[model samples]
Target: MANFIDKLKPALAGSREGPPTSAASRGPSPFWVMVRKEFGDHIRSWRFVILLAIVVLACAGSLYASVSALKDGQSASAASGEGSSSFLFLKMFTETDGSLPGFLTFLSFLAPLIGIALGFDSVNTERNKGTLSRLLSQPLYRDDFLNAKFVAGLLLIAVVIFSLGFLVMGMGLFTIGYPPTPEEFWRVVVMLLITVVYVGLWLNLSLLFSVRFRQAATSALCGIALWIFFLVFYGMIVSLVGNATSPADTAAASVVIRHQDWMMLLSRLSPAYLFQEAASTLMLPDTRTLNPFITQDQAYLAINAPLSFGQSLLLVWPQVVAIVAETTVSFAAAYVAFMRQEIRSRS
Candidate 1:
């Protein structure tokens, strides 16, 4: 009887193993596997750790300044009956005690650093180390490898940005003793998403450089140089163009508005400008338009009435679309370049 049971066990085991597993039942796809590996690498990398530390410290300092300012403003707000506390939650992002800039200011300056650091060496470094050829030598397709790298970096950016944004919101809730309205909460979520998109623009740009340049340092420098150009020099160039194209001093209001409109269009070419406009409008409901030149009609409009969340979103929709378009174009360029590169193994 024991021998019969044993012989049956073998048959049962063979039957269980008889059916071949389909691809879907096999483990995760190669693309996802590579994504996980790259995401883990970014989290553990020293550069990422250093950048995150700097960002966290900056957030802490700005939050402290903002909270102190808000507390001081409370008395005036209560006495005036202006109900400043209504949007108190959003103010934490745009308000500061003058010693340090607000949260948005810090984020605008530092977020790009995070993106650039994560992706500046993504492709070239692997190639230089002779790992690129070996990685492609496996079951991984070129698209999977490239897409995984970008997707992993994007996931990391989302994690970092969303975490910090919510951390600030949580701290504000505790410190201010005021829960955000649903509208304010949604606005904050949108702003954080915009921030992620803005950072992704830089990430994709760096990825493009990594694919184009053989040396990681060259790619990194190119990324930083472009950042510096937009942050510092681009505004000056815009100003010069605006001035050169300035209308006569006695020009009609319509003419002046057109000139200003053209300047606004030119400035929007810079992603930094687009980001600032979007962040400010989203966080501050009082903003009515992106135009710097206020027409007489707008000047006569009431100042105390803040736009609803939907309205604010509509106002910034173009800026948001423009940033997304730029990011997509950059990633597409990188994809094409990387796919065309020849992979060679080296000792």
Candidate 2:
């Protein structure tokens, strides 16, 4: 009996020292482990590759068009007395080819798709493959999974946005033969950051749908539907509502002003609208105010010179706040939904 007890004691001691029993004792935090896993998976996936290639090609084409237009504009300005020859580096982002939209416009249009693509299947795919249960059974907390996914998606977005912004600037420098001014560089950086935030909002929205729906297709379709509604139909609806609420006769300035303000408020409810307003204001320094009802004095102040970077940011600060608030609300909702979700896989 003494020998038997001695043998068992060795076994017990070996088990105690063999492996970690708690998550913290692991080599790294589960959150970071999961983040690295998700980021790698995203970068390697065919979906990411295809989408990134599309964006790069589109940007390259848009930059080509913009540079050509800038050259023409510069030559015309040299020939004419009306055009000003300042901030040519900044013009590369804001200037349009005959009918083509600028680089910023292209970004605003496609950035949401990238975010949605990254998040639409984040959870549902794991569940569909019967991995969610196994994954959660590891030494990890539930929130870690969700938080890691959100952070991974955000990091992906930041990389892509900043890379493209830098690429555009580099191409512009080679072709336009001028570097961006300090103010222009900072403005571009701010625009890129805002774009990341804008796309992050869509990422959270899609992630929420991913958590709520068991099917990936359903979540993807829901996200696309929301995007279409905001991007296409929301503006039309706002216009109709404003016309319906407006006075029939254009006699009262106050009434007209009220109607315009109501329309602006309603339009801002859409993330797409908020992003466009903010991106446009950031890219184009000449834009002084988002408010259409600026007083004569304000208009007079803005006519002779472009607003400083600080003033431009100030003008769009409300839009920035609204976008950030919407992003936070979406992420919070996703976090709650994921936390309350059942981990059981459907047979």
Give the winner by lDDT.
1
Residue-level lDDT of model 1, residues 4-116, one tens digit each, is 98789889888786456666679888899999999999999999999999999999899999999998888778788876666889999999999899999999989998889
lDDT digits (tens) for residues 1-347 of candidate 2:
85998889889988887556576565778899999999999999999999999899878888988998988888888888766866778889878776677898789888999999999999988988989899999988999999999999999999999999999999899988888889999999999999999999999999999998988999999999999899999999998888778886856888788878888999999999999999889888888778879878777766677889999999889999999999999999999998888888652
Give lDDT for model 2. Answer: 0.90
Collision pairs in model 2? none
Deviating ranges (above 4 Å) for candidate 2: 1-26, 301-303
Runs off by more than 4 Å, candidate 1: 1-25, 79-83, 301-303
Estimated TM-score for each candidate: 0.90, 0.92
